[model samples]
Target chain A: MKFRSMLAALAVLVLGAAQAQEPIRIGSFLAVTGGAAFLGDPEQKTLELYVERLNAAGGVLGRKLQLIVYDSAGDAEKARTFAKRLIEQDKVDVIVGGSTTGETMAMVPLVEAAGVPFISLAGAVVIVEPVKKWVFKTPHSDRQACERIFVDMKARGATKVALISGAGGFDKSMRAQCLQVAKNHGIEIVADEAYGTGDTDMTAQLTKIKNTPGVQAVLNVGFGQSPAIVTKNHKQLGISQPLYQSHGVASKAFIKLAGDAAEGVRLPAAALLVAETLPDSDPQKKVVLGYKREYEARFKSEISTFGGHAWDGLMLAVEAIRKAGSTDKAKVRDALESIRGFVGIDGVFNMSATDHVGLDISGLRMLEIRKGDWTLVK
Target chain B: MSGRTASLATLAGIVLLLPLALQNNYYYEVAIQVGLNAIVCVGLNLLIGYAGQISLGHAGFFGLGAYGSAILTARYGWPPLAALASATAGVAVLAYLIGRPILRLRGHYLAMATLGMGIIISIVIATEDRLTGGPDGMPVPALAAFGAALSGERVWYWVVGATLLAAVWLALNLVDSPHGRALRALHGSEVGAEVTGIDSARHKVKVFVISAVYAALAGSLTAHYAGFVTPAKVTFFHSIELVTMVVFGGMASTFGAVVGAAVLTVLPQALTVFKEYEMVVFGAVMMLTMIFMPRGLVPTLALTLSGRRLPR
Candidate 1:
């Protein structure tokens, strides 16, 4: 009896060791439980979608992909620590997805040292700039968004514009780029103002922008209540000039929060949210509609650019793994760089090592809220 | 030896050996943060413990210092060390100006005033995108001193440790001096201390300004070390966290502040195993600690170990 028990114990130990070595784990650090839950909850769903789809098509290198996610509450320092733990302890094959640029950059050093591919969802050029081989991004960079907004603004005849943005990661970069883009395009930015995360009133800044001479339009950047602030306050102050919002405010939440004031607010958005507005014959239309149907059916919530970012990040990572035919970071990164004509929910992705930003201005469609409904303006 | 002296000696020895002992970059990172928290809490303890004043808006000073340094370095191309000095000086001036009127109020009024200061700073930091980089806060110029940039966890650990040690030593010296005693006397009974010839209002304002400088210096160090600063660093939440460390460690004891900061910092990391439940457990522990041992972890633990319960 004692001999039999010893043999069984040895067998169990062997099984445990083999099971541990079976699969490559991918770590996802998101704001899953914090103020950014509106963003991270969908991020978790997209990650799951990737995992399921990858497994359905025969797992990466015949090894089932394991995903580990942590909630950093959109805190950069916390994200950094979580990234380290994921690399060192969880032993993830790659680190994917971050809620904010601050959180994503915080992971750069650790993931680089750990020799894992880090694909960020945050729209910061710094995330992939001076491009480390191990670091790549799937989101449109802040610079691209800035260029797109200005290009659209100039096209729309918004020459003299006032700028107001929330003092958040994406908005900060976007605002800087907007100013540079304005200088290049000869778009006179009359007034520039800012606000914080939890601010409810932006009357002072909005008032300043309203009072600025020759301000034909307002370029509102940042996320959360800031966009809502511009929307409501602009109407209240009777500043009927054109309002151009950053992609950060391209959300149903913004509309809901801003009430009737959200009407007639033009913003740049990925084609995913308003895919139905595109003709059925459009190739990108089918994939986006499919995601919209599936996402609404499952999550019962409206999709936003934020979720579209997650969808793109997750799908791209899965595609790279499949193309690489292995969980190896080097191979996966090469495959990611080589991605061509990949129709994602966000945009048609064509990534290369030199250009980690898969989608550019072409992929983004101009969206406007007209009478509390999202309409494709261009 | 007095418990304070012994605790200070132990802290000094630990800090001295910390860089050598912690070879891991992760630990170095945590230690660097602990040092930063210790600096903030030590400054906060001056107001809460010695002067018996509360400022819920200390984070405003911290934010101003961080944003001041970040903008100076990033926009003006000022050297980081020079920026740090200028930022600290700027905050000191701002604090004195803001505190002159606000500190006159007592208790909740004072708390509310400080809270307003924090809110105003946050608003300014958030809105002034042209100047402060707005709510996303600006990236700090890397901590460069004498032409070399301070990067990596190991270097930051030493710099922060030395700064924290100096702060503690300064605070310790102040607490031991006649000025500290006068502050303490004022804390115990303002009228009595005034009767005993301590300039109650002057001492309060002085301690308030001193504490603000400490917070500002700590904020500058934090921004330089992290190579970034956001308004979140000086938000009300951060102020509350600093106050928590001071009160949780034993409000009157400077060593208690350090211990509180260290324990709270490490606790969250250790409790990461609980995952989402960690927050719940953290809240529970905090509540229970405050309810049962209001003097804080260090004093309560000391008292227990000495086979004496805290006097009701």
Candidate 2:
């Protein structure tokens, strides 16, 4: 009888422990390999650091945070499959992932169907446009980036622009947005040319744009080596027009790839790139610099805007969880949408029912490359 | 059962049992992808393995079918079934037109021509922003039949699985038929097949058109299943991957093609948990498999198990 009583007490203790230790599961899929590894690697590192910090601080709502990550390798099909697994198999409460626009768009239908809150890190307008009920993103959309660039161009008295875009999804979207929003920004596109992603020499396209009349500025829309090649080719061709690049090339790697040619080339980027330069009174200054310092210190590498995206996504989800005071998906989504004036490393997020991303044009800062380093335009 | 019948039975058994074993939506989704790829590989095997023709542009046909159906059903409001049928027919016509000229070229020339064809198609799709939604791709509508929208991976699993089985059965029967004999003759030697009263050009073009239709059908199913279509699906890399599956499974064997598709589709997904080591492991696994099983996985395994050469 005494042994039976002891066993019952042990069972009670186990059940109580299980109930008390129910962790908040956050699942993510990133392009941690393949062509988009630069974006995903830093995002993965940020999530790891954030989760460690959050858990060490006694977690959210008195329960530990559990992070489950999958490597998508920048494949849309892989992203879709991983999204399903995160939702159906892992049963995660929240998801933050799809480090590229293609991969993020692929997971939209699945996330919508499952009714899970998805915080995307991809920089595309389509991911949040028309307002997916459960979907949100951290990075400013390509459209926003275009608007920011055009606004800066207008301030610089540039009226006509030449567009040299790479034939990739991000490039295509930015190119379309540039054409669509140019008139509104009082900018006219004089010439539009495209090069393949693998094209190393864009001198021919740049020459055509250079010959076009009324082209005051040349804007290149692409990510990775293509933009760098365009920069090099533009200089090689000796085009006197100022060059503007899309936010897709917002990294030191692009400057490094372009070498001396990247000097004076301007692009709009997240504030994290110039965190140290932000005014002390700015709300996002401390958060951005703190993240950059911690990340660089821990990983022994410079932080990029891509990692800032992951930081904003994780913090947003945690904030929503705390506000909702429960692990319920619906409540968390509502809380996410209702979050206002939440200063994150990306921007001061003010989420609403219609605006999922919550960042405006002010979120992007005009940056120019100076001596192979990023410098904020005053 | 005969060997052919036994293989068919085994395939059927696998198709029926896979869903039961993998009850989650993710597994069902992966299974559906395997089935779609298997359908394409089965047709590609017939062209590359049986007919002795090299096509580096099958993904062009796949893309044509996807964009065709997506544009029709999503934009033009045509019925999904009609769109699928018309897309398949269109791809067949396209294949026939291109095949007549390209099939006449031999060896590397033929390979280059097909490669050019694939690249041209993808470029057109990528550049034509007004129609094809440009490189950002466009969403596809859900496939509906009998007034009910087909949603969920479970439903697609059955549809895609049955279609794959039908494809395999048709390929097997074709392989055993007189046309199959003539193609095999051509594969052995084009001059010998012509001497034996086989019209080599006619058979080559016919196989090309048929394989394109197969790829088109698979592409249509995939677009509807994923509910999105992109030029990435029609790129040179995708075409190469499809051809590699056929070669990796053992050319000319219908079951081999299916097995090849299943393995290649599942391998990367299975290795995703390995994170940074995933690609390294995947490459190493593929290299090891190729090095050890040079004749392809199924035929090599069959040879090892039965200790006799299997007829191709």
Candidate 3:
């Protein structure tokens, strides 16, 4: 009986070792509980859903994918600590995370030092501007959004614009980028106004913008409820100039919060926002629609662009791992940079040595909130 | 050993031994954060606990230090050490000037004044995109001393740990000094302290300046360690969290401040395992702790276990 028990234990150990050898580990830290939960929750859900689906389809590179996620709670310090834990303790091959700009930037130095591939889902340009060897991003940058919006405005003959921005970090960066790009595009900003994040009303700022003569368009740059409030206040104050919001307000929640006031408001957003509306010729439509259907079905909620970012990040990492044919960090980093013509939920990713976020202004489609629904502008 | 010496020694021992207990870089990073926060709280305790003054704007001084050091080092090509020293001195001078008039207010009036000051500072930093980099914040150059740039969590853990010990020692010495006596007298009652010939206004202002300097030093250290500075560090919420650490640790006791910082900083990191329920559990834990120990965790636990009061 003792001999039989020892043989059984040895057999169990062998099976366990074999099972662990072919599992690929992907780690992430996201703001799952704090202010950015709206972004992180969807991201976390999408990563889980895709990991399950990918495994069911026989996994990548003949290995099952394993996910390890931590809640950063929208704190930069927490994000840094979790990034270290994921790299040092969990020994994850790649990190896809940081729901906001500040958190992502905080982790940049650490991940670079650790020599791991980091694919950030945040929308800040700085995360990839310098192009750290190990760092890449999936979201459309604020700079791209600014350029797209300005290009559209220039085409419409809206030369003079007024800028109203929120006090948050994302809005501040977007506002600066918009100001910088406006002059290049031959657009003049007439008035610049700012609002606190918790301000209940923005009519005072809107009133100033309305009073500014030669202001052909009003551009509102912010995230969350502030942009929505600006929309409502703009409509209520009867500012007849065209209202353009930043891509920060791409979600359905903005329309829900702004009520009928969101009608005719335009912004640049990921192609995922109007996946179903895209024509058959558009490459992103099929990939985005597939993700939207699967995510909505599994989670019982509408798909968000934030979730598509997660899908793109994970798929990019998986593609790199498959191409590398090994979990080696250096090889995967090279593979990620060299990847080209890969269609993702966000857009076609074309990474290069100098450009980590290869998607350009073309990745963002001009979307208008028509009757509280996202409608693509031709 | 005297109680003060014994406590200081115990703190020193823990600082030396903590790395052995930490299994990875993440714990060291968290420990470094705790040390930085404890430095601020220890000084804050002097103002609130000893001087009986409230400052809802302490983070403003902290921000000033961060931005001052960052601007000097990153923009003007000044050495980090010189910038840190100058920034700290600048914060001290600013605090002395602001504290004179604002420190005269009592109770909620003082609280409101401080809150206003913090909001004003935050707004100025956020709006001034030319110098301060506005709300997106600017990168801080790394600290280099002894011809070497500071890097790694282990190195920062030691630097911050030693700084925290020195801060605690200074605060403890002050508590045992004549100024500390006068400050405590005012904390007991301003009328009573005035009757005893204590210049209550002068003492309050001095403590406020000292505490501001402490927060400034911590802020400078943090900016160097993290290599980034944002207006978020100087926001009103950060000010409240600093004050809360002082109160939650046991106001009068220096060790309590350190304990409070350590527990609160580590608690959230440790609770991240709970995932979606993490915040709910954290709130419940805080509520339960406050309910059971009105004097805070360290003091209340000491009283219950050894039947002795902590040194004020």
Candidate 4:
């Protein structure tokens, strides 16, 4: 009779714990409307769609998911202000956003002080360098992009390279990173040419590169219209040297804009670009194909790797919350740090204490643009 | 004089009691931004309203002040307070030198000159990657005194709030002074003011320098408070935003400028409730506000409240 009564009491306590309604809050500040909208728009959509699906699956630890997104419009000050609101007012359990390096760095001090786990979607190495306790990122850093390009160039037996960069933040940072790592790869920078932010014509700089001798390959370290313009100018000038680009131009829009000139142009980017082309045995293939299919089906837009970064970030946060089995801030952060062998869209993340951004040189894949589509270089 | 004293006392009371209503650090951040913008707008109002001059490049002075103090304390090892003062004084000198020549041009020509100047400053800041950390922006050290870092949102609120009060006080006094009268006369008509021996050129130059100083001081304080500096504020869009705040607050009114700063600063954050329609709604609100009030929020409301004849 005592055993039966005790069993009834245990059932009542367990049922009560699962019946609570307080939702786990995930806060985000993205550049959804302004300068960096192309990146933030897809990211916002992915997060919203996935969060709905997670909640539909009866959420982690038996709690619903609440996502609060604030668009910073690519403004650093606005990013900081929205971060404060997210922390103090919303009291979110985890933060998994920051589209630009500027916005990411701006929110670093706040999240660290508040002791919230922040997973940055920004591509700057500075976001994870020196390893602040509360910050992690899902994107490959610009330095890694530079190092990867150099190693590829070395393998191709290209001893000399001409860098044509635009003055945008990413362009300049990648250019510097390339310069920093060229010596290590035994590559020499033959000519360094730069175009202003809004310059549509780069034939002037292309002519200079064309005249420079011993330049075996030309690399443009820019993303926006300028890189496409450089591609056209590279073709118009009839310079047959192999062309390379940064991962910044890893979008279908670049192919549409560059058209015939995009043929044979090489760049390093995440495997999410060629998700459908991956083998069945690959671990990341399933995750990448799942995201691409769902996103394409829902948003009716071609998937870009920028959105893949957000997918990685959000899933990591959700996994951490699940691992902790509770919404405790300190415990969740610890769970995030201890995450191992997790496969996501960005890379197979292996986070450790010293390295906040766990994906290394192997995460990036080299691709050649053939007939206006991305093909694995093998 | 009594009215001015009363306004100052009221401002003081509000500043002291505002902390009670602040729920947390988020409110303090918004409040601090409002204070900083108000300091710049108050000085800007003196030039645009009292002097009838338009500056499309005030952000250049503000950016210069920000980068100056940031580089001074971080690179040169100067004390924070000293760097702030020096940056302000440097901008004052630059404004005075350029104002004499640039103020000679009137109306659209003057506007063009200032616009060109702002563009030049922004370009230089972006290009000089070595010293200024290029386009990615540089980190600013925390405001320190006597070898101790004076940090935290609440502490900055007191500092910026006190500075904003001082800026308004100075603007009010200037408007009531002899120079202020001259500026107002010049705004009415340069020839008429010159006929009355108002020295329109000199008064214009002095007020220009004064306004630039205000922007520089606010910019320096903002750099220290945010603990980061970027060229984002130095752009032409930011200068236009400042002008919009001045016009929105009701030109020539010090308290109106403060209200304008607060409203515009808070509106963007509040409009997030509308989600995707934020920019559209922001534009609509700005348009409707301008359509109805015309003289801006404070002045139109003041006239309505006092039962005065609406100015045609």
Q: How far in Å is the alpha carbon of A348 misplaced in model 2?
A: 0.5
Of 1 and 4, which scores higher on DockQ? 4
> Candidate 3, residues B1-312: lDDT per residue as tens digits?
299999899999999988887777866777898999999999999998888899999899899988889999999999999999999999999999999999889999999999999989888987786788776577888999878999888888889988998999999999999999999999999999999899998999999999999999999998899887767788899999999898889888888899898888878766765767888998998898898888887788888899776457
Descending-lDDT candidate ranking = 4, 2, 3, 1
Q: Write the per-residue lDDT of candidate 2 for residues A86-132, one digit (tens) a residue.
A: 99867899998889887888789888988999999998788999899
lDDT comparing candidate 3 with the true structure? 0.88
lDDT of 1 by residue, B27-133 (tens): 67777888888888898999899899998988888887777888889999999889999999988888888878887899999998889889888777866767875
How far residue A66's Cα lies from its native spot in candidate 3, in Å, is: 2.7
Q: 2 or 4, which is superior by DockQ?
A: 4
lDDT of 4 by residue, A72-168 (tens): 8888888889999899877899999999888888788889999999999998787888899999999999999988888888889997999999987
Q: Which ten residues in a row have the lowest lDDT in candidate 2 chain B?
A: B267-276
Which model is ahead, 2 or 4, in terms of TM-score?
4
Instruction: Mark the 10 consecutive residues where model 3 chain A has the least summed lDDT.
Output: A1-10
lDDT of 2 by residue, B1-312 (tens): 287788999999988987666756877887888999999999999999899889999999999999999999988999999999999999999899999988999889999999999999999998887777877678889999989999888899999989998999899989899999999999999999999899999999999999999999999999899998877789898999999999889887888899899889988776755667877998898899899888788878888899886566
The interface root-mean-square deviations, each candidate in sequence, come to: 9.3, 10.2, 9.4, 12.9
Arrange candidates, best TM-score first.
4, 2, 3, 1
Give candidate 2 misplaced runs (Cα > 4 Å).
A1-20, A203-215, A232-241, B1-3, B307-312
For model 1 the interface RMSD, in Å, equals: 9.3
After superposing candidate 3 on the true structure, give the runs of residues whose Cα lies further than 4 Å from its correct spot.
A1-18, A183-193, A199-215, A232-241, B308-312
The order of the candidates by DockQ, greatest first, is 4, 2, 3, 1
Off by over 4 Å in 1: A1-22, A52-58, A88-91, A105-116, A124-134, A142-172, A175-179, A182-222, A225-245, A254-266, A324-331, A368-372, A375-378, B1-3, B16-23, B146-148
What's the TM-score of chain B for every model shown? Answer: 0.95, 0.97, 0.97, 0.98
